[model samples]
Target chain A: MSIKNEILKIEHLHKAFGENVILKDFDLSVKSGEVIVIIGPSGCGKSTLLRCINGLEDIQSGKIYVDEQPVIQGSKDLYEIRQKIGMVFQSYDLFPHMTVLQNITLAPMKVQKRKKEKVEKEAIELLSRVGLADKKDSFPRQLSGGQKQRVAIVRALCMHPEIMLFDEVTAALDPEMVHEVLQTMLELAQSGKTMLIVTHEMSFARAIADRILFLDEGELIEEAPPEEFFTSPKTDRAKKFLQTFEYSKK
Target chain B: MNWNVIREYLPLYIEALGLTVKIGWLGIILSIALGLVCALILYFKVPLLQVIIKIYIELFRNTPLLVQLFFLYFGLPKLGIRITAQTCGILGLTLIGGSYMTETFRSGLSAIDSIQSESALSLGMKKHQVFFYVILPQAISISIPGFMANIIFLLKETSVFSAISLMDLMFTAKDLIGLEYKTIEALFLLVVFYLIMLLPVSLLGTYIERRVRYAAYGD
Candidate 1:
């Protein structure tokens, strides 16, 4: 494989809410087309890290560089920076008032000022890609949970973002619905989209991640190829963590 | 009790109804505008303006509309601020109605979940765009029921315009009674006209509430 350029870099990040420190001195970097899965126990800053990258949450004392541009909260360029990063949430927060096509086409036409015809055409294509073409005119209340999640993915993808952030996207789905959402994500990963995923689905993480990052207590405890990390985790924390998944699987 | 007296006053009652509706509509529009502005200010916490709006809401909401109309019409002229009684009626109604509207809109805005805004922002929308395109629509939908109630309340409040001598419905009734002592006829006409003015609005509110609820929740 040819060498890829780094697209995202986080250095010496510190984030806290009031007196509670969530992330301390956290550092990470991702190259183009790299799929990084962040796996950790709850409250370990997995979701917070993604939020910081998207400029949703403010950081205390660190810098995040996306495509060499700083992601500063309240900056004039933050809107431009956010256009390059697409984020999908766990709750699939589709705007309840708008139909699926309206929800998907809203930002591209309004924020980016793209042509309505072009944006609608592109939205329909993406919807078909997610197998939701027939449901385009339906409101969010009409769709099933898995279908809403897929439509949300199409909403994010409609921006043509350079990097996509998935924050526990399938954690809220029913058991049968999780597969469809995960399958859509797997296809996205296969298409070489740079993705940072925070998930509790160990098997899905192992299947799609180029590198698996183990985080505990807001620290990067270990990083390795998925095969190595799953087979022979270096730290006792990783070992114990993987064992819980193993026990749950049985 | 006298059908002849009611028949004799029909034209006068019609003219009074027209004036009452005109004033009611003007008051409703102005109060909604004022209320929306104050609500947005408070919702976004616009520095010093938010503090002023809070005081304005408390003052207007606590005081009776009658007192407010008296002050605007009777008291302001003594201070060299001579607005017409018509202006006083509309202005006073707006002041009190605006405060109620502000609370109504504020509750609507607050009821929207933060995640909705977050979703819009993450899609690369600016703060204002998020507010206009995403937040405001949902907020307005959530606020339809309250907005309708405020409209009806403002219309009812228009009856108090007679206190300022603006020739509204109540003034027409009181004038007819004082002139001819047709207490039953005048009061009966007043009741009928008020129902005519307010019934459609009340019914429209219910219709809109149902439509908005169905669109939002499919219920």
Candidate 2:
């Protein structure tokens, strides 16, 4: 894809927590409307990289350009940058005090400064899209795990962001509930929304991602289209990790 | 013992009780304000302010209200800051009430969901805005019972001001008991005074608790 068409450009990114390095010399560019799923061993900085994309985490030495806009070394524009991006976390992160509809409408009402009536209408519409329009008045604690994750997806979508970042959003859900969230994500991928996900669900990653990235120990060991990436991993760790199916079986 | 005396002193007794209400409300308002401000300082770990507030709370919480009242009314005058006994009551109540109030608010804040802060931060709310808008509105609900309890305690403690010559209800009793030498009548009048002071407070407290429960998470 052309540089003008790419939505996210990450170059020579390096980060560490004190002495423990997480991402080192990493480089990737995401084209508009493509889905990229990153999978790796625990503590490989997959989630950290997603966080840096939306300015949630600061990269130690390098740059992340979102919508061709640099995210590194800036002040409060991080919020403006963040306004263009939406993130869904592993915990669902829905405000328990708010009803599902209130949760969906909160950001749009506050940050976007939309009128209350308009946002409430939009919230109901978004809820229908996630198949929980009837649950609008329910608090988050009242919802099931699958229902909560769906609400979270719609909440992120309510902002109409150019890029959506998912950090293991389904990792906290039960096995029976994972399929509903994955289906919502699959439907989202079909909608041509630019997305970056760091998830442990390998088969879902294989089914939906345009490109699959495998990392181990802070390095991108392999990048390929799903069929080739899974059939033939290049690195020793990738080959061994996939054979063990460490995350897949679990 | 006499119906005529009960009727005659009834107006004066009621008058004294009204003064108790005024002082009690004033002291409560001041103490709650002081408590909230001090709790905020302690919550954010402000420089030396946290340490100072911590010691202040401990000092007040450990000491009796009468000693603190006498100290503020009589003791501080030696150092040139002589406050009236009424002012002494307000000050003493604030010092003591605020300590317990701070603890109540602190626990209320602790009961809040941690992600609520992160959610507020992600929304670009300033730190103070996050607390006031997102955290404290909900925390206020949790803290109301404790706040009302502390206020009731302060109202009851206002009786101690009679020792320092404040004209609050207990002081009126002191004067009446001395003037009439009617110990039973004076003591009995005080029982009514205490009931009137605390009854409304308890009822208001229960009302606030119910309202807050609805606001916090009631169906």
Candidate 3:
């Protein structure tokens, strides 16, 4: 898909761990308010790509630009770059010690130096949006998997990240609770925030992905709109991969 | 056998207890602060600081407290720097306590999540803001019990100050033993004196432990 309105640009990105070349010269562009989904077999570097976008994993060579500024070349302030690029990890990396409300408001009150009343007001509203308003005072360990993931999304949103990266957020949830998290992401996408989701659930991808890019062993095998990408998959890798799509049955 | 025999030295006991408390509490307070700073440095490893703090902790923590007291009290004087025995005792406790404090707080700092710092940073907080608002507050909370336990250890360690001729409880007890030849009564009073001082530190440690657990996990 053409990305003339791209807000995030990944150019010649490369990463390797020892002998393992996870991502080799991979690149993509995310247009303004676009919802892009990345799907790949395990160890295909899908999560690493998302992590690199948010600056969690460094690119060995390439550069990532967010909002026309070089965000990945070790030039942009890390905290500021991170503020614009929010990430929800597969593990829901919430502060275990903080309550749900505190988790959501921590970054806003501290980094934003926002007024306490304003932060709390927005935090409560966000929590209520996730259907977790009553759990504001509860610690992370008390919440269900779905609740924690929703809180994680809200926590990321509290920073008002320009681009939100979701790394298989539903992968860790019980099968029954996966819908809640996907539904939250759907709502978040509807809010006009740029979203990049790496998920295995084909149906979820098909429903929300503006452009679906399939990765296999670090190669971007297919990049097309979800409809054509899922139905008329062009490449042999994409066809074989689609033929082996057992995970979508559940 | 009469309690009145010890009554004559009641005023002395009070004075000795006061000195014990002063030296012990001061040493512990100073040591905990020093140790925590060292631990933070080594744990987070701020630029060029880890090595210096590591060496300081190794030097103070590995050496015996008595040896430290002797070096500070006698060696410093021989080096043309003279300070009082009280100063030496407090200094010794802090030096020794600092080593252990670094060890305790370091683990507590490491135990906490790096994500917390990320969370704080995403909020646009500076380094100090992250440390105080997220890192140090949680670090101190988790390390309080260990700190109290260390203070209790410091309290008992201060009894060794009598060796340097400080007027703390143990020295006074030694003087009382010498004058009365009632070693049994003097030693017994000394034990009673220590029990009274140390019980509170232990209890306070337990209290802080419960408080942190309740706050963090609502236990």
Most accurate candidate by lDDT: 1
Find the number of clashing residue pairs for candidate 3.
2
lDDT of 2 by residue, A1-250 (tens): 6779888889999988889898999999998899999999888889888877766667789888878778854576766667667788887577766788877887788777889998899889878888899999888878899999899888878888888888898899999999999999999999899989999888899999999999888899999998998888877888887776754534
What ranges in model 1 sit over 4 Å off?
Answer: A1-4, A246-250, B213-219
Root-mean-square deviation (CA) per prediction: 2.1, 3.2, 2.8
RMSD of candidate 1 to the true fold? 2.1
Off by over 4 Å in 2: A72-74, A243-250, B1-12, B123-129, B171-189
Off by over 4 Å in 3: A1-4, A73-76, A235-250, B122-125
Model 1: per-residue lDDT, tens digit, B86-108? 88888888899899999999999
* Model 3 Cα lDDT, one tens digit per residue, A117-211: 98899888999999999999998888889999999999888888888888899998999899999999999889888999999899999999889
lDDT of each: 0.92, 0.82, 0.83
Q: Higher-TM-score candidate among 1 and 2?
A: 1
Ranking by TM-score: 1, 3, 2
For model 2, how does the per-residue alpha-carbon lDDT over B148-208 read when each residue is reduced to its tens digit?
A: 8888888888888878877777887778888987777777878987997799879989987
Candidate 3 TM-score, C-alpha based: 0.91
